[model samples]
Every structure is written in structure tokens, then in C-alpha cells.
Target chain A: MYELIKNLGTWLTSGSSWTGTDGIAHRLAEHLQYSLLATLVAAAIGLPIGLLIGHTGKGAFIAINLASFGRALPTVGLVVLVFLAGGLSMLPVYVALVALAVPAIVTNTYAGMTAVDPDVKDAARGQGMRGHQVLFQVELPLALPLIMTGLRLALIQVVATATIAAYVSFGGLGRYVFDGLAQRDLVQVLGGAVLVAVIAVTLDLALSGLQRFLFRHRTA
Target chain B: MTIDWSWIGDHTDDLTTLTVSHLQAALSAVFFGVLISLPLAVVAHRIRPLRGFLLGVSNILFTIPSIAIFVLLLPISGLTRTTTVIGLTVYTLVVLLRNTVEGLDSVPAKTKEAAKAMGTRPLRTLLTVEFPLALPVIMAGVRIATVMSISLVSVATYIGDGGLGQLFTDGFQRDFPTPVIAGVVLTILLAVVADAALVALQYVLTPWKRRRA
Candidate 1:
């Protein structure tokens, strides 16, 4: 056990820590940039679609089904599909992440909008608030919490699934985990896994904090 | 690149076999997950400290990458049905445990008091009052777990385990889009069906939610 601890300690302090230049950190950053971009793009597209579907109140079933279908498309499978379709670069990764992020955002946005207090909406309209004004001032603020919940879910998923980009040589922390497995390097593999868990938990906490900050008034 | 319909047509048997296997794995995982989580949730509920510890542990487990779990388990257990089931079951724990606790907690205090006032035994009250009230939330957790298990089963292909994942890995290696597409399509279909069935079950179990609807 002491030997085991010693080895682990050495692995942690080794010069070749996965985050060294040309290593895990650089790769992770690249993947994160792409994943974040994809998720943001997905939020841009999905949030509006969700809001529209919720407002019209006619296409709830369709919107929900579409989102479910989006979730059903496994990230890795989508990546392979894009790879086969002659787009093997980060484009495939980005597209897959975007696709994966859509369902949660859309579902949450719709739910959040519809859940706004009917009385508040009516009051806004009674006060001569225009449709757009009511939406921005009354609906959006009320719905923001749920919308943020969806975004948080999407962000966590994007971070978790972005590791799959390693399969396409896009070089994320997944490289360390997968390559470590290939080489039977438990230290590296465990380290990478630990990093991912840490990242996910940290992001979750940060989002929870942000959600509290944004929705404090409502909760209060 | 043109789409290949003929290839998909030719591999229908293989596709069906893979889908069946994938469904089998997911169902088994969910079964075991519910089995383990329900008891654990009950224990945690009875013991507040245990509840906090287990909840944190499960949350940590939930964030651990599915691939990492697959990799870590494969060598220890070897690539077998047991490994896949165990890994997926652990994955479902976070969802199932939370849902179970939430479900049980959702039962009204007045309802429990009524049961007690009627001189119902502890076990009887749990079965007739608590469990029944918690069923909807529990079912919702099961729905989520089932979907998660289905998706993770596909990732299990990395270890040469389970059916649909086999199709995915094979299709990727051979550059055959047919099996891959078939596997993805079937997986999606299964998720939709499962989700709808669970929603229906939730409605049946909690008529109040239905009335609200």
C-alpha cells in the first residue's frame, strides 16, 4: 500500500502530468472551446424554438417529441455519422454536441415559459403591455430560472460528452483516459477520470450558484 | 456522399438482433438499479447521516464518465454481461435513489397520521400509504434511469460487451453506416416508446397529475 501510494504520488507530480504542454490541458481546452461554442449555438436555436412552441401552445407534443429524438441520437453515433459524411474535423464534434444540447434547452425553455404565473401575464397585458413587452418583462424574467436549469443540464452534458471527441483525434482529456487504458497506465486513466469528475461537479456547483443569484428574488 | 439504402436493407436481421440485445441489457440494468436503490433509499431515509453520505456518493458516481466506468470495470471483471449490468446499475443509482427518497417524502404527513390513527402497522403503513404515494416519483426516476441505461449500454461496446454497442463499434471500424444507423434509429425508437409508456404509467399512478393536466 505504501508503494502504491508512492507511485501515485510520483505520477501526480511527474513532469508529464497530462496537463503539460501538448498534453491533456491543451487538448481539454480545445475540446471545451468547441463544446461551449456548440452548446451556445444550440441554446440560441433551441431556446427560441422552445419559447415559440410554448407560446403557441399548439405544438407541445411535437416539440417534446423532437427534443426526445434529439436526445436519442447518441453523441458518439452522431460523430460517426458526421465522420462518414465527409466532415471529420471538429465540425462533427461541434454538430454532435449541439444536437445533444438541444433537447434539454428546448424542453426546459418551453416548460419555464408555460409555467409563468397566469395572473402576472394577465396583469402585464392589462397594464397595456404590448405582446413583446409582456414577453420580455413578464414572461422571460419569470421563466429564467427554469431556462437556466436547462442550460445547466446542457452544459454539464456537453462537458461530459465532449470527451468523446478524443475518438476522432480532436484531443480532449478523454485522450488521457482512453490512451491510458490502451497503455495500461492506471495513474493516467484514474487521473483523467478524476479531472472529469472534478470539472463536472465544479461546473454543477457554479451553475447552482448562478441559478440562485439570478432567481433569488423569485425564491424569496 | 450518397446515402446507402441497400446496405440497411441487407442487414435487417443483424439490426434486429442488436436491438434486442441492447434492450435486454438496459432492462436488466434498470431492474437491478431499482432493486438496489429502493432499499438503499429506504435505509438512507431512516438514517439521515446515511442519506447525506449515500446521496453524495451517488452524485459523485453519476458524474464519473460512462466510458471511464466501462474501462475501469472491464479489466477488473473482464468483458462480460455482469460488468455491463453492474456499471449501468451504478449509473442509475443516483437517479433512482434520489427519486425514491423524493417519492417517499412526497407522501403527506396527514396521510401517515391517518394510517397511524387507524392502528395500521409500520410495515402496513409503508406499503399501503408511503409506497403508493411515492410510486409516481419513483416511476419518474425509473423512466430516467431506463433512458440513461439504454444510452450507456451503447457505450458498453468499448469493452466488447452488449448488443447495440457491438453494432456501433463494428460499423465504425468497417465504415459501414448501415448497422450504425440501424442501431441509432432503434435506440431512439426504444427511448421514445419507453418514455411514453412511463408517462402513461405516471398518469395512471398519480391521477392528480392527470387531473391537473
Candidate 2:
């Protein structure tokens, strides 16, 4: 165990591993690229639909069912299927990641919007706020915390799934893991796992902090 | 990229075996998950100060990806099925513990008081009254955990024990789409079936809910 830890420490701190084309820096960038692009596209698609159904209180059945269906999807299956169908490119990674992410965003957004007090909406309307105005100013603000929660959940899940991108010959922190496994290099594998865990925990903490801030701002 | 229908046709036995393996992994994880989570949730519900800390630990555990968890356990569990089950069970803890506690909290104070008035022991009241009333919420958690476990088991392929996820890795390596498609379809089907079965179980277990409806 001591020797293994020493090897891991050496692998993680090695200057060569920190630089060059195949380095941790480049791989981490690629991983974030996949995660962020997919999340942005998902937010573009999911947010509008979620807000629409949530604001109008229609098609909620479809939204909820869609979210559940997304949850049941196997990320590995989807990623590999898309890779096979779409050919080896970044597209499949994005497609699979986006598909995985949209559900949490949609469901949470809808839940947040709907959970806004009916009395608050009534007051906004009575104040002569237009429908769109009320939705934008009153509903959206109140829904920020839940919406952030959804985004946080989506981002975390995407980061995890994005690790599988390396299996398809893409670049990311997962490259270390898959490559380490292939070579039976436990040190590299442990290092990769630690990095991924760090990213996930850091992201969760940052988002949770933001969520708490939003919640506090609202109450104040 | 097209699926080879003929390949699927020749693989029925293999498919069935893989499906069974998949279900066994997922189900056992959920079983042990419930065993561990139920006690934690009970304590969390009964003691107000401990709830946040317990849930927070599970939340952090849940953030770690399934692949990472499996790999992290490799040194200790040596890439065995034990690693898969343990990792998956840890993943289920967040949902199960949170939902069970919420379910227990949903039981009305008045009902618990009435049970206590009848000289019922705390444990007995919990088993007979609170647990029964909490069944619906707890079952919802079970459904979510079942689906989650089913999907996550596919990622266990990298660890050499993903069950149906084997088909995915095979097809990916062979650059064939048939097994991958089959794996995807079957996984989704298994999750849906498991969820539906749980729904039915909840209905049967909560007869009072049915009577009211």
C-alpha cells in the first residue's frame, strides 16, 4: 500500500504528465469542453421547454415522463450506440452527454417553477404585470434555486459520463483510467480516479454554495 | 452503423444470461442498499441534529462517478463482483436514505401519539404504523434506485463485470452495432419493467391508499 501510494504520488506530480499533448492539462480541458458544450446545448433546449410547461401548466405529463425516460437510459449504452451510429467524432460524445443532462435540468426547472406560490403569481398578475413579465421577473427569480439544483445535477452527471468518452478514443481525464487499465498501471488509474473525484466534489460544492446564496437572497 | 438483426437472432441464450446477470447485480445492490440506508434513515429521522451530516456524506459519495468508484475499489476488492455491488450500493445510499427519512417524517405526529396512547412500543409503532404509512414514499425511492442501479451497472463493464454492458464493450471493440443496440434496448426495458413491478408492489402494500383512491 505504501509503495502504491508513492507510485501514485510520483505519477500525479511528474512534470512530463503535467505538460505536452497527452498531459493532464490538455485532457482536463477536453473533458470540460465536452461537459460545458453539452450542458449549454441542453440548457438551451431544456430550459425553454421546462419554463413553458411550467409557466402554462400544460404538457407537464409529457415533461415528467420524458425526464423519467432519460433517467432509465444507460449512459454507456447511449454513448457507444451514438459513437457507432454517428461515427468516431466529438458529436456522439456531445449527443450522449446532452441527452444525459437534459432530464435533470428539465424536471428540476419545471418542479421549481410550479412550486412557486400561486398567491405570488396572482399578486404579480394583479399588479398589471404582463404574462411574460410575470414569468420572467416573478417566477424565474423564485425558481432560480431549483433551476440551479437541476443544472448542478446535470453538470455532475455529465462530468461522470464524459469520463466514458475516453473509451471511445476521445481525450479527457478518463484517458488516464482507460489507458492505465489497459496497461495494468494501477498508479495511473488511481490518479485519474482521484482527479475525476476532485472535479466532481469541487463542482458540487461550488454549485451548492451558489444555490444557498440564491436561496438566501430570495428570503432576504 | 446499422444493427445486424441476424446477429441478434443468433444470440438469444447469451442475451438471456446477460440479462439475468444484470438483474442479479442491480437487485442485490438495491437489497443491501436498503438494508444499510433504512437504519441510517431511521436514526436521521429520530435525531434531528444528525440528519444533515448523514445526508451530506451520502451526497458526497453520490458525486463520485460509478467508474471511479469501481476503480477505486479495485485495489481492495480486486475487480470482483463484490466491488461492483459495493460501489452500486454506495450510489443508492443517497436516494434511499433521503427518501426513507422523508417518508418517516411524513407520518403524522397525531397518528404516532395515538399509537403511543395505546401503549405501543416505539419499535412496534414504527413497524406497524409509521412504516406502513411511509410505504408509498419509500417505494418511490426504490423505483428510482432500481432504475439508477440498472443504468450504472452498464458502466461496470470497464471493471469486467457489467453484465449486459459486456455487449456494449464487445460491439464497441468489434465496431459492430448489433450488440450495442441490443444492450441499450434491453437495459431500458429492464429498468422500465423493474419500475413497473415496484409500482405494483407499492399498490399492493398500501391498500389504504387504494381504498381512498
The C-alpha TM-scores of every prediction are 0.88, 0.98
lDDT string, candidate 2, A86-200, tens digits: 8879888888899999999999999999999999999999999999999999999989888989999999989877888898898999999999999999989988998898898
Chain A TM-score, each candidate: 0.90, 0.95
lDDT of 2 by residue, B68-175 (tens): 999999989987889999999999999999999999999999999999999999999999999899888898898899999998898899999998999999999988
Q: Relative to the unseen true structure, what is the C-alpha lDDT of residue A182 in candidate 2, on a scale of 0 to 100? A: 99
Top model number, lDDT: 2
Best by DockQ: 2
**lDDT per residue as tens, model 1, A43-141:** 998999988876667799988777657756767777877776765678878888888899989999999999988899989999999988888888888
TM-score of each model's chain B:
0.92, 0.99
For each candidate, report its DockQ versus the true two-chain complex.
0.48, 0.84
Quote the positional error of residue A75 for candidate 2 in Å: 1.1
In the range B44-137, model 1's lDDT, one tens digit per residue, is 8778889889998898787667777776675468778888888889899999999999898898999999999999998899888898889988
lDDT on C-alpha atoms for all candidate structures:
0.80, 0.92
Pairs in steric clash, model 1 = none
